[model samples]
Target: MSHVRVAIPKKGFERFEKYNPENLKSFEQLIEEQNGDTYCLKLNMHLLRMYNAYPQLVNLKITRLILLKALSKLPYQHFNFARKYLIWSQLIDDGIRVIIDMADLLENEDYEEFWMHYKQKATILPILDGFDEAIRKYICFKVGSTRTTVPCMEFKMKLAVDKEVLMKYITQLGWMINGNEVKVFPLMLNDSNDRDVIRGIICSDIR
Candidate 1:
Protein backbone atom coordinates (compact mmCIF):
# COMPACT_ATOMS: atom_id res chain seq x y z
CA MET A 1 0.00 0.00 0.00
CA SER A 2 1.23 3.48 -0.82
CA HIS A 3 1.30 5.63 2.29
CA VAL A 4 0.36 9.30 2.09
CA ARG A 5 0.83 11.77 4.90
CA VAL A 6 -2.20 13.68 6.16
CA ALA A 7 -2.43 16.61 8.59
CA ILE A 8 -5.43 16.80 10.88
CA PRO A 9 -6.43 19.69 13.15
CA LYS A 10 -6.56 19.73 16.93
CA LYS A 11 -10.33 19.41 16.86
CA GLY A 12 -9.98 16.46 14.53
CA PHE A 13 -7.68 14.91 17.12
CA GLU A 14 -10.33 15.51 19.74
CA ARG A 15 -12.93 13.81 17.60
CA PHE A 16 -10.70 10.83 16.88
CA GLU A 17 -10.10 10.46 20.58
CA LYS A 18 -13.79 10.79 21.27
CA TYR A 19 -14.65 8.00 18.86
CA ASN A 20 -12.05 5.33 19.67
CA PRO A 21 -9.32 5.68 22.23
CA GLU A 22 -7.61 2.39 21.49
CA ASN A 23 -4.45 3.11 19.53
CA LEU A 24 -5.99 6.50 18.79
CA LYS A 25 -2.58 8.13 18.70
CA SER A 26 -1.69 5.66 16.02
CA PHE A 27 -2.99 8.15 13.44
CA GLU A 28 -2.88 11.42 15.34
CA GLN A 29 0.88 11.89 15.64
CA LEU A 30 1.28 11.23 11.94
CA ILE A 31 -0.77 14.33 11.26
CA GLU A 32 0.96 16.45 13.89
CA GLU A 33 4.47 16.20 12.45
CA GLN A 34 3.31 17.50 9.09
CA ASN A 35 4.25 21.13 8.40
CA GLY A 36 0.98 22.95 9.07
CA ASP A 37 1.44 25.41 6.18
CA THR A 38 1.25 22.77 3.47
CA TYR A 39 -1.54 20.37 4.31
CA CYS A 40 -4.01 21.88 6.76
CA LEU A 41 -5.39 23.70 3.76
CA LYS A 42 -8.31 25.91 4.81
CA LEU A 43 -9.68 23.72 7.57
CA ASN A 44 -10.08 25.21 11.04
CA MET A 45 -10.14 23.58 14.45
CA HIS A 46 -13.94 23.92 14.64
CA LEU A 47 -14.52 22.26 11.28
CA LEU A 48 -11.97 19.60 12.13
CA ARG A 49 -13.93 18.69 15.26
CA MET A 50 -17.16 18.57 13.32
CA TYR A 51 -15.72 16.35 10.59
CA ASN A 52 -14.03 14.04 13.09
CA ALA A 53 -17.16 13.61 15.17
CA TYR A 54 -19.10 12.30 12.16
CA PRO A 55 -16.35 11.16 9.83
CA GLN A 56 -18.38 8.50 8.06
CA LEU A 57 -20.56 11.26 6.68
CA VAL A 58 -18.20 14.21 6.34
CA ASN A 59 -14.80 12.59 5.74
CA LEU A 60 -12.92 13.20 2.49
CA LYS A 61 -9.93 10.90 2.85
CA ILE A 62 -10.84 9.05 -0.32
CA THR A 63 -10.68 12.28 -2.27
CA ARG A 64 -7.42 13.15 -0.59
CA LEU A 65 -5.99 9.80 -1.59
CA ILE A 66 -7.10 10.20 -5.16
CA LEU A 67 -5.46 13.58 -5.52
CA LEU A 68 -2.33 12.38 -3.83
CA LYS A 69 -2.01 9.31 -6.06
CA ALA A 70 -2.33 11.29 -9.26
CA LEU A 71 0.13 13.93 -8.08
CA SER A 72 2.65 11.65 -6.47
CA LYS A 73 4.20 11.01 -9.85
CA LEU A 74 4.44 14.68 -10.68
CA PRO A 75 6.64 17.45 -9.41
CA TYR A 76 5.37 19.25 -6.34
CA GLN A 77 4.79 22.40 -8.34
CA HIS A 78 2.38 20.50 -10.58
CA PHE A 79 0.03 19.60 -7.72
CA ASN A 80 -2.14 22.62 -8.24
CA PHE A 81 -2.69 21.67 -11.84
CA ALA A 82 -3.51 18.07 -10.93
CA ARG A 83 -5.96 19.16 -8.28
CA LYS A 84 -7.75 21.51 -10.64
CA TYR A 85 -8.01 19.16 -13.59
CA LEU A 86 -7.60 15.48 -12.76
CA ILE A 87 -8.94 15.36 -9.22
CA TRP A 88 -11.97 17.56 -9.79
CA SER A 89 -12.75 15.82 -13.06
CA GLN A 90 -12.65 12.39 -11.47
CA LEU A 91 -14.70 13.58 -8.52
CA ILE A 92 -17.45 14.83 -10.79
CA ASP A 93 -17.70 11.59 -12.72
CA ASP A 94 -17.72 9.41 -9.61
CA GLY A 95 -20.24 11.55 -7.77
CA ILE A 96 -22.85 11.39 -10.50
CA ARG A 97 -23.41 7.60 -10.43
CA VAL A 98 -22.98 7.57 -6.66
CA ILE A 99 -22.00 4.32 -4.95
CA ILE A 100 -25.24 4.11 -2.97
CA ASP A 101 -27.26 4.10 -6.15
CA MET A 102 -25.12 1.41 -7.71
CA ALA A 103 -25.19 -0.84 -4.61
CA ASP A 104 -28.77 -1.82 -5.38
CA LEU A 105 -27.72 -3.11 -8.77
CA LEU A 106 -25.57 -5.90 -7.42
CA GLU A 107 -26.71 -9.30 -6.25
CA ASN A 108 -25.33 -10.97 -3.12
CA GLU A 109 -23.08 -13.21 -5.17
CA ASP A 110 -21.80 -10.32 -7.23
CA TYR A 111 -20.18 -8.66 -4.22
CA GLU A 112 -17.64 -11.44 -3.77
CA GLU A 113 -16.71 -11.31 -7.42
CA PHE A 114 -16.45 -7.54 -7.34
CA TRP A 115 -14.46 -7.55 -4.12
CA MET A 116 -12.02 -10.11 -5.49
CA HIS A 117 -11.52 -8.28 -8.74
CA TYR A 118 -10.96 -4.91 -7.07
CA LYS A 119 -8.64 -6.36 -4.49
CA GLN A 120 -6.57 -8.08 -7.14
CA LYS A 121 -6.27 -4.85 -9.04
CA ALA A 122 -5.31 -3.02 -5.86
CA THR A 123 -7.98 -0.53 -6.77
CA ILE A 124 -10.31 -1.52 -3.99
CA LEU A 125 -9.56 1.66 -2.11
CA PRO A 126 -9.54 4.11 -4.98
CA ILE A 127 -11.17 7.47 -4.71
CA LEU A 128 -14.92 7.20 -5.05
CA ASP A 129 -17.05 10.20 -4.18
CA GLY A 130 -19.74 8.15 -2.50
CA PHE A 131 -17.31 5.71 -0.93
CA ASP A 132 -18.95 5.88 2.46
CA GLU A 133 -22.32 5.11 0.92
CA ALA A 134 -20.89 2.23 -1.04
CA ILE A 135 -19.04 0.85 1.98
CA ARG A 136 -22.17 0.99 4.13
CA LYS A 137 -24.26 -0.81 1.56
CA TYR A 138 -21.58 -3.44 1.00
CA ILE A 139 -21.17 -4.07 4.72
CA CYS A 140 -24.93 -4.44 5.10
CA PHE A 141 -25.03 -6.97 2.30
CA LYS A 142 -22.02 -8.84 3.61
CA VAL A 143 -23.46 -9.49 7.08
CA GLY A 144 -26.68 -10.89 5.61
CA SER A 145 -29.83 -8.92 5.00
CA THR A 146 -31.43 -9.69 8.36
CA ARG A 147 -28.54 -8.27 10.41
CA THR A 148 -29.37 -4.82 11.84
CA THR A 149 -26.00 -3.70 13.13
CA VAL A 150 -24.93 -0.67 11.11
CA PRO A 151 -21.16 -0.83 10.75
CA CYS A 152 -20.85 2.93 10.48
CA MET A 153 -22.89 3.50 13.59
CA GLU A 154 -21.04 0.83 15.50
CA PHE A 155 -17.74 2.42 14.51
CA LYS A 156 -18.96 5.81 15.67
CA MET A 157 -20.08 4.48 19.02
CA LYS A 158 -16.74 2.81 19.61
CA LEU A 159 -14.98 5.93 18.40
CA ALA A 160 -17.01 8.11 20.71
CA VAL A 161 -15.82 6.23 23.78
CA ASP A 162 -12.23 6.33 22.57
CA LYS A 163 -12.47 9.99 21.68
CA GLU A 164 -13.76 10.89 25.13
CA VAL A 165 -10.99 9.10 26.92
CA LEU A 166 -8.36 10.49 24.55
CA MET A 167 -9.54 14.02 25.14
CA LYS A 168 -9.28 13.67 28.89
CA TYR A 169 -5.85 12.12 28.55
CA ILE A 170 -4.59 14.81 26.18
CA THR A 171 -5.84 17.60 28.39
CA GLN A 172 -4.15 16.08 31.39
CA LEU A 173 -1.08 15.55 29.23
CA GLY A 174 -1.09 19.22 28.08
CA TRP A 175 -1.73 18.73 24.39
CA MET A 176 -4.17 21.55 23.89
CA ILE A 177 -4.63 23.82 20.86
CA ASN A 178 -3.36 27.35 21.25
CA GLY A 179 -5.37 29.15 18.62
CA ASN A 180 -8.33 29.16 16.25
CA GLU A 181 -6.29 27.76 13.38
CA VAL A 182 -3.03 26.00 12.65
CA LYS A 183 -1.08 25.88 9.41
CA VAL A 184 -0.20 22.47 7.94
CA PHE A 185 2.55 21.43 5.53
CA PRO A 186 3.38 18.40 3.47
CA LEU A 187 5.87 15.73 4.60
CA MET A 188 7.13 13.17 2.16
CA LEU A 189 7.69 9.58 3.21
CA ASN A 190 10.85 8.82 1.22
CA ASP A 191 10.83 5.09 1.71
CA SER A 192 8.19 2.35 1.72
CA ASN A 193 10.06 -0.04 4.06
CA ASP A 194 9.65 2.09 7.20
CA ARG A 195 6.27 0.81 8.26
CA ASP A 196 7.42 0.25 11.83
CA VAL A 197 8.64 3.83 12.17
CA ILE A 198 5.44 5.17 10.63
CA ARG A 199 3.32 3.10 12.98
CA GLY A 200 5.37 4.08 16.03
CA ILE A 201 5.29 7.80 15.25
CA ILE A 202 1.56 7.83 14.69
CA CYS A 203 0.93 5.93 17.90
CA SER A 204 2.75 8.52 20.00
CA ASP A 205 0.93 11.47 21.55
CA ILE A 206 2.24 15.01 21.00
CA ARG A 207 3.35 16.89 24.09
Candidate 2:
Protein backbone atom coordinates (compact mmCIF):
# COMPACT_ATOMS: atom_id res chain seq x y z
CA MET A 1 0.00 0.00 0.00
CA SER A 2 1.18 3.59 -0.58
CA HIS A 3 2.16 5.17 2.72
CA VAL A 4 1.55 8.66 4.08
CA ARG A 5 3.81 11.39 2.70
CA VAL A 6 4.31 15.12 3.21
CA ALA A 7 6.38 17.61 1.16
CA ILE A 8 7.93 20.84 2.29
CA PRO A 9 9.68 23.63 0.40
CA LYS A 10 13.38 23.43 -0.44
CA LYS A 11 12.94 26.86 0.96
CA GLY A 12 16.51 26.94 2.15
CA PHE A 13 14.63 27.68 5.29
CA GLU A 14 17.38 26.22 7.37
CA ARG A 15 20.04 28.49 5.92
CA PHE A 16 17.82 31.42 6.49
CA GLU A 17 17.05 30.20 9.96
CA LYS A 18 20.70 29.79 10.76
CA TYR A 19 21.82 33.10 9.37
CA ASN A 20 18.76 35.21 9.99
CA PRO A 21 18.59 35.24 13.73
CA GLU A 22 16.99 38.65 13.69
CA ASN A 23 13.96 37.14 11.99
CA LEU A 24 12.89 35.80 15.36
CA LYS A 25 12.75 37.25 18.83
CA SER A 26 15.51 35.12 20.28
CA PHE A 27 17.87 32.28 19.30
CA GLU A 28 16.00 29.87 21.56
CA GLN A 29 12.78 30.94 19.89
CA LEU A 30 14.33 30.25 16.50
CA ILE A 31 15.32 26.74 17.49
CA GLU A 32 11.87 26.03 18.91
CA GLU A 33 10.28 27.31 15.72
CA GLN A 34 12.33 25.02 13.51
CA ASN A 35 11.56 21.98 15.64
CA GLY A 36 8.20 22.03 13.90
CA ASP A 37 9.53 23.17 10.53
CA THR A 38 10.14 20.57 7.86
CA TYR A 39 13.70 21.80 7.25
CA CYS A 40 14.70 20.94 10.79
CA LEU A 41 13.00 17.56 11.05
CA LYS A 42 16.16 15.56 10.35
CA LEU A 43 17.19 15.96 13.95
CA ASN A 44 14.36 13.82 15.32
CA MET A 45 15.93 10.38 15.09
CA HIS A 46 19.24 11.47 16.55
CA LEU A 47 17.53 13.61 19.12
CA LEU A 48 15.45 10.68 20.24
CA ARG A 49 18.42 8.35 20.33
CA MET A 50 20.56 10.83 22.22
CA TYR A 51 18.19 10.90 25.18
CA ASN A 52 18.53 7.15 25.51
CA ALA A 53 22.24 6.53 24.87
CA TYR A 54 24.22 9.56 25.95
CA PRO A 55 22.27 12.49 27.24
CA GLN A 56 25.55 14.10 28.16
CA LEU A 57 26.53 14.50 24.50
CA VAL A 58 24.42 17.37 23.21
CA ASN A 59 26.04 16.97 19.81
CA LEU A 60 26.15 13.47 18.31
CA LYS A 61 28.83 12.61 15.77
CA ILE A 62 27.78 10.10 13.10
CA THR A 63 30.96 10.08 10.95
CA ARG A 64 29.11 8.56 8.01
CA LEU A 65 32.14 8.61 5.76
CA ILE A 66 30.71 6.26 3.13
CA LEU A 67 27.59 8.33 2.67
CA LEU A 68 29.74 11.43 2.41
CA LYS A 69 31.72 9.88 -0.42
CA ALA A 70 28.52 9.07 -2.25
CA LEU A 71 27.37 12.66 -1.98
CA SER A 72 30.49 13.95 -3.72
CA LYS A 73 29.61 11.98 -6.87
CA LEU A 74 26.42 13.91 -7.59
CA PRO A 75 26.13 16.47 -10.40
CA TYR A 76 25.83 19.50 -8.15
CA GLN A 77 29.00 19.48 -6.07
CA HIS A 78 27.40 21.55 -3.30
CA PHE A 79 25.88 18.34 -1.98
CA ASN A 80 29.32 17.22 -0.96
CA PHE A 81 29.46 20.22 1.33
CA ALA A 82 26.03 19.48 2.79
CA ARG A 83 26.86 15.82 3.18
CA LYS A 84 30.06 16.64 5.01
CA TYR A 85 28.15 18.87 7.36
CA LEU A 86 25.68 16.12 8.21
CA ILE A 87 28.43 13.60 8.83
CA TRP A 88 30.31 16.03 11.00
CA SER A 89 27.17 16.95 12.93
CA GLN A 90 25.88 13.36 13.21
CA LEU A 91 22.69 13.97 11.23
CA ILE A 92 21.08 11.18 9.20
CA ASP A 93 23.11 10.17 6.16
CA ASP A 94 19.98 9.49 4.16
CA GLY A 95 19.00 13.07 4.67
CA ILE A 96 22.33 14.00 3.14
CA ARG A 97 21.59 11.76 0.16
CA VAL A 98 18.16 13.20 -0.37
CA ILE A 99 19.47 16.74 -0.19
CA ILE A 100 22.23 16.00 -2.68
CA ASP A 101 19.91 14.23 -5.06
CA MET A 102 17.42 17.02 -4.85
CA ALA A 103 20.03 19.71 -5.32
CA ASP A 104 21.55 17.95 -8.31
CA LEU A 105 18.19 17.73 -10.01
CA LEU A 106 17.34 21.32 -9.35
CA GLU A 107 20.61 22.99 -10.34
CA ASN A 108 22.54 20.66 -12.60
CA GLU A 109 21.73 20.00 -16.25
CA ASP A 110 23.30 16.59 -16.57
CA TYR A 111 21.00 13.61 -16.06
CA GLU A 112 22.60 10.53 -17.61
CA GLU A 113 24.78 9.76 -14.57
CA PHE A 114 21.99 10.82 -12.22
CA TRP A 115 19.66 8.34 -13.91
CA MET A 116 22.16 5.55 -13.30
CA HIS A 117 22.14 6.22 -9.59
CA TYR A 118 18.33 6.20 -9.31
CA LYS A 119 18.19 2.94 -11.24
CA GLN A 120 20.19 1.38 -8.42
CA LYS A 121 18.20 3.13 -5.62
CA ALA A 122 21.51 4.63 -4.63
CA THR A 123 19.71 7.96 -4.89
CA ILE A 124 16.16 8.86 -4.04
CA LEU A 125 13.96 11.22 -6.08
CA PRO A 126 15.52 14.67 -5.94
CA ILE A 127 13.65 17.89 -5.34
CA LEU A 128 12.82 18.84 -8.92
CA ASP A 129 10.26 20.88 -10.82
CA GLY A 130 9.44 21.85 -14.46
CA PHE A 131 8.53 18.43 -15.82
CA ASP A 132 4.88 17.88 -15.05
CA GLU A 133 4.11 17.89 -18.73
CA ALA A 134 6.82 15.35 -19.42
CA ILE A 135 5.57 13.16 -16.59
CA ARG A 136 2.16 12.91 -18.25
CA LYS A 137 3.79 11.71 -21.45
CA TYR A 138 5.99 9.18 -19.68
CA ILE A 139 3.03 7.73 -17.82
CA CYS A 140 1.29 7.26 -21.13
CA PHE A 141 4.27 5.59 -22.81
CA LYS A 142 5.57 3.31 -20.07
CA VAL A 143 3.40 0.51 -18.74
CA GLY A 144 3.81 -1.79 -15.76
CA SER A 145 7.12 -0.10 -15.06
CA THR A 146 8.59 -0.29 -11.57
CA ARG A 147 10.13 3.15 -11.99
CA THR A 148 10.60 5.84 -14.60
CA THR A 149 13.31 8.51 -14.82
CA VAL A 150 12.03 11.55 -16.62
CA PRO A 151 12.96 15.21 -16.91
CA CYS A 152 10.38 16.22 -14.37
CA MET A 153 9.96 14.35 -11.10
CA GLU A 154 11.30 10.78 -10.91
CA PHE A 155 8.59 8.21 -10.29
CA LYS A 156 8.39 4.54 -9.41
CA MET A 157 5.52 3.08 -11.37
CA LYS A 158 4.23 0.15 -9.35
CA LEU A 159 1.05 -0.88 -11.10
CA ALA A 160 0.19 -4.36 -9.79
CA VAL A 161 2.64 -5.17 -7.04
CA ASP A 162 1.15 -6.84 -3.99
CA LYS A 163 1.72 -6.00 -0.33
CA GLU A 164 4.46 -8.62 0.04
CA VAL A 165 6.66 -7.16 -2.69
CA LEU A 166 5.79 -3.74 -1.43
CA MET A 167 6.87 -4.36 2.17
CA LYS A 168 10.41 -5.32 1.26
CA TYR A 169 11.25 -1.97 -0.35
CA ILE A 170 9.21 0.39 1.75
CA THR A 171 12.06 1.79 3.73
CA GLN A 172 13.87 4.89 2.37
CA LEU A 173 17.26 5.99 3.63
CA GLY A 174 16.32 9.56 4.55
CA TRP A 175 12.56 9.48 4.11
CA MET A 176 10.14 6.63 4.81
CA ILE A 177 8.85 4.84 1.77
CA ASN A 178 5.28 3.65 1.77
CA GLY A 179 3.40 1.37 -0.58
CA ASN A 180 0.70 2.28 -3.12
CA GLU A 181 -1.43 3.37 -0.20
CA VAL A 182 0.92 6.24 0.56
CA LYS A 183 -0.49 9.74 0.12
CA VAL A 184 1.93 12.55 -0.78
CA PHE A 185 1.08 16.20 -0.57
CA PRO A 186 2.63 18.02 -3.50
CA LEU A 187 4.80 21.04 -2.89
CA MET A 188 4.35 23.30 -5.92
CA LEU A 189 7.64 24.57 -7.25
CA ASN A 190 6.63 26.05 -10.60
CA ASP A 191 4.64 29.11 -11.30
CA SER A 192 4.14 31.13 -14.47
CA ASN A 193 6.28 33.98 -13.16
CA ASP A 194 9.16 32.96 -10.89
CA ARG A 195 11.45 29.97 -11.31
CA ASP A 196 9.79 26.85 -10.02
CA VAL A 197 10.75 26.17 -6.48
CA ILE A 198 12.10 22.67 -6.14
CA ARG A 199 9.10 20.37 -6.09
CA GLY A 200 8.67 17.01 -4.25
CA ILE A 201 7.67 16.39 -0.69
CA ILE A 202 10.09 15.66 2.10
CA CYS A 203 8.95 12.20 3.18
CA SER A 204 8.77 12.02 6.95
CA ASP A 205 10.56 8.71 6.78
CA ILE A 206 13.51 10.39 5.11
CA ARG A 207 13.52 13.45 7.32
Error of 2 at 35 (Å): 16
Write model 2 residue lDDT over 28-54, tens digit each, in one string: 222233311222323322232332343
Residue 85 lDDT, candidate 1, scale 0-100? 27
Per-candidate Cα lDDT values, in order, are 0.34, 0.32
Model 1 TM-score is 0.21
How much RMSD separates candidate 1 from the native structure?
A: 21.2
7-48: candidate 1 lDDT, tens digit per residue: 445534443534443332334334333332334322222223
Off by over 4 Å in 2: 1-84, 89-102, 123-207
Top-scoring candidate (TM-score): 2
The TM-score of candidate 2 is 0.22
In order of appearance, the predictions have TM-scores of 0.21, 0.22
